[model samples]
Target: MNLLKKVTALLLSLAIVIGSIFVGTKTNSYAATSKSYIKELKIGKTYYYNLDGGKYKDKIKVYVSKNDNLLLRINDKTIKVLKYDYEYSKHNYNRLPYKCNVRIYNFNKKDKSLEIVLNYREDLQEGYRILKFKNSKCLLDKIYNDSYMEKYDSNTGAITLSEGNWGLFKDFTDAIGRFGCYYKIQIKGYKIYNPYTSNTTEDARKFKYTADKNLNAYTNTNSSKIAFTVKRDEKVNIYSFYQKGNKKYIKVKNSSGKYGYIKIGSSPLFEEWLMVR
Candidate 1:
C-alpha cells in the first residue's frame, strides 16, 4: 500500500508539471498568432493580412516603405499599391509611393485639441470613404474633401480606404477587383500638435554624394528596371532612402539631372559604394 501511494503521488506530480508545460505552450502560441494592424507597421518588416474584413480568404503579404508605399504579394503575383493622395508628385507616372501634406490648424476654438487635416491636390479618390479606426475598432468620423481644410483632429487613428467606384483595379495592374483590396494606412512617427514640415524642393544639393563605382540606377526600388546608370566617381543627389525586403535603395539624381534609385548595399555596406559629401 505504501509503495502504491508513493507511485500515485509521483504520477500526480508529473501530470501537474506536464499540464503547466502544456498551458505555457498554448499561451505562447496564442500570443504569437495575435494579428497586428497597420498602425504597427515598421520599415523592412513584412505583415500578413487578409482583405475586406477577411471576406477574401487569401492571405496577403504586405511590404511598406518609409514613405508608406505598399507592395502586396497575393496569388503568386506582386502588386504595387500607392496612396490615394499624390498631388505633390510631378514627374513620376507610376506612383507607387503616395505623398500627402499633413497640417494642424487651430481653426476651431471650441475643441481643446488642434484640428489636423490631410491635404490632397488630386481628385482620384474624391468620393472614397475614409474609414477611421482607434485601437483597431472602427470610428464614425467625417473626412472633408479640400486641398487645405481642417479634417482630422489630433488623435492616433488608423485610416483605411473603403471600396468605392474608384477601385484599386484602376491603379493596380493585376485586376484587383476580385480581391476586394482596400488600403490600410495610418499616420505614425509624426508629432501631433507640432510644427512638422518636409522640404519638397527638387534641389538635390542638400544630400549630394558621388558614386564610388559604376552603378545601375533603377526607375523604381526594384533593381530590375534600370532607368539610368552612374559612372564611377559621378556626383549624384540623394533624395531619400527606401527599403524593399532586405535590400536598401537611395532615390538619387545622376549627373544627367534625372531621378532614379541606386541599390545601396545591405547593413554594414549600405554606403560602401558611395562617397558621402
Candidate 2:
C-alpha cells in the first residue's frame, strides 16, 4: 500500500510539471504575437518622415486613425488620404499608393521610405461645376492663387473645384459678403458644402437676398407685367437666376410668400440696390 501511494504521488507531480510547461509555452507564444502586432501598427500616432535625407521632409506630418485612415497636413492644410488604383510596393503594405488630391504619396514598410508623386491637376468626377468667374478680380484671381487650380473635364463639360474652393465659395457667398464689385454666376444643378463639414448635401436651391432699394418683380424675363413689388430693406429668397442682354434676373420669394423675379447687375454700385445674404 505504501509503494502504491508513493507511485501515485510521483505520477501526479509529473503531470503537474507537464501542464505547467504547456501553459508557459502558450503564454509566451501569445505574448510574442501581441508584441509583434503592436510594433506593426501604431494607430492614432503622428509619424514624421525623416528617414530619407531630403530637405523640408519634416514639414509634412502624417497621422493614421484607429480605422486605419491616413491624413496629411501640409502648408496649414489638412488632406485626407484616399485609396487609389496604383501599384506601390512588393508587399503592398496597407496599399502604399494613396492619393491626397493632386499629390500621391506611397509608403513602404520594409525600408520605411516615403515616395511623393505630384500631378498638375486633380482627377475630376462627373457633374462638377467649373466656375468661370465673370470679370471679378477676387473670384478670377482665386483660380491662380489657389494651391490647385480647378480642372475642366472636356468630356463632362464640368470643372473640378478643389476642397479649398468649396470653402471659399461658401464663405464668400453666405458668410462674408463679396465687396467692391458684386460676383454674379449662373447657378447650376445643386450646391454642395465642404465634404469635411457635412455629409449631406444642402438644399441650396434658394439663397437669401436683401433688397437695398424697392424694386418691381417682373412676371417674366421679357414681360412688362409686374407680379409683385419688393420693398427696400426687405429680405427675399432667390430660387433661380439668368442672364439677359447685359442684365441678370433672379427669381425670388418674399417674406409674404409672394414669388417674383428681380434684376441684378455687375455694376460697382450694384450691392447698394441688392445684396446676397
Candidate 3:
C-alpha cells in the first residue's frame, strides 16, 4: 500500500514539473515574439504618430506630421485629413479637412481586413470618413452622410455591409450607387449622435443647445407634472424663467406652443436647434 502511494506521489510531481516547464517556455516565447505597431510623436502641446495600422502601412510609409493640418502620409501618397477648428474653418468647415487623430483604429490578419475611424471634432459627422482595407489594399473610403449613418440604427458594434438586402439603399447615400456590390466596413467606432437633440459645437454655449432629456412640463414651479411629457427631439421655446429653492426651472412652450414649466438645463439659452434665417 505504501509503495502504491509513493508511485502516485511521484507521478503527480512529474505532471506538475512538466506543466511548469510548458508555462515557463510559453511566457518567454510570447515575450520574444510580441510587438507593438503604434508609435506616438508629440510636439509641444500638439501630437502626431507613426502607425503600422494594417494594410496602409504594409507596403508604404504611414505616419502623421506635426503640421496644423494633420497630414496622413502613405509612401509618396499624402492626404491632408484633419484641421483644428480655426476661425476660417467656421465659415467653410464643411469644405475643409475634418478634425481627426493619428492612430490604428483596427486590424485583422486572418480576414486580411483593416478598418479606421477618422474621428472629427465637430458635432456634425457629415464630413468624417471611414477607411476600409482588404488584402493589403483599400476597398472603400466612406464619408459620413445622414442617409447612411442613420442606417446604423443604434448598432454600436462592428457591422459589415457585404451581407445586406439594401435594395435601393444606394439612392439615399452620396456614395456612387453601385448595384449588386457592397464593401466590407466596420461601423463600431464611429461616434454616432442625433444632430437634432444634442449640442454639436466645440463651444456648447456658442451653439443653440436643444432638449436632450425627456422632461415634464409642470403646471407651475411646483414638482407636480402636467399631462404633457415633452417629446424627444422636439423644439423647446423658453416662455419665462423661475427659481425654486436652489434649483432653476424654465417655462417652455412645446411644439404646439403650449406653455409649461420645465426644469432648468432642459432647453437652450441661445437659438433653436437649427439657425432660423
Give a tens-digit lDDT track for model 1, residues 61-178: 4354455454333334434342422333533566534344332333322322222233333434332223222222333233433111112222443333322213322221111111
Q: What is the alpha-carbon lDDT of model 3 when measured against the actual structure? A: 0.36
**lDDT of all the models against the reference?**
0.36, 0.35, 0.36
Predicted structure 3, TM vs. truth: 0.28
Candidate numbers, best TM-score first, in rank order: 2, 1, 3
Task: Write down the RMSD of all candidates, one decimal each.
Answer: 24.7, 27.7, 24.2
Q: Which stretch of 10 consecutive residues in model 1 shows the poorest summed lDDT?
A: 172-181
- Rank order by lDDT, top first? 1, 3, 2
Clashes of each: 0, 0, 0
Instruction: Give lDDT for model 1.
Output: 0.36
lDDT of 3 by residue, 1-277 (tens): 2676446534533443343222212122122211122332222232222223343343223344444344443334334343443334545655655344433433333343334445344432222355654343454555543211212212333322211112212221111111111222334332222121111111111221244456678887765868477765555544333433445555566767677766554333322221211
The TM-score of predicted model 1 comes to: 0.28
Model 3 residue 73 CA deviation (Å) reads 2.0
Q: Which residue pairs collide in model 1, if any?
A: none
Put down candidate 2 lDDT per residue, 181-243, tens digits, no spaces.
111222122221221111100122222344556788998777778999987656665554444
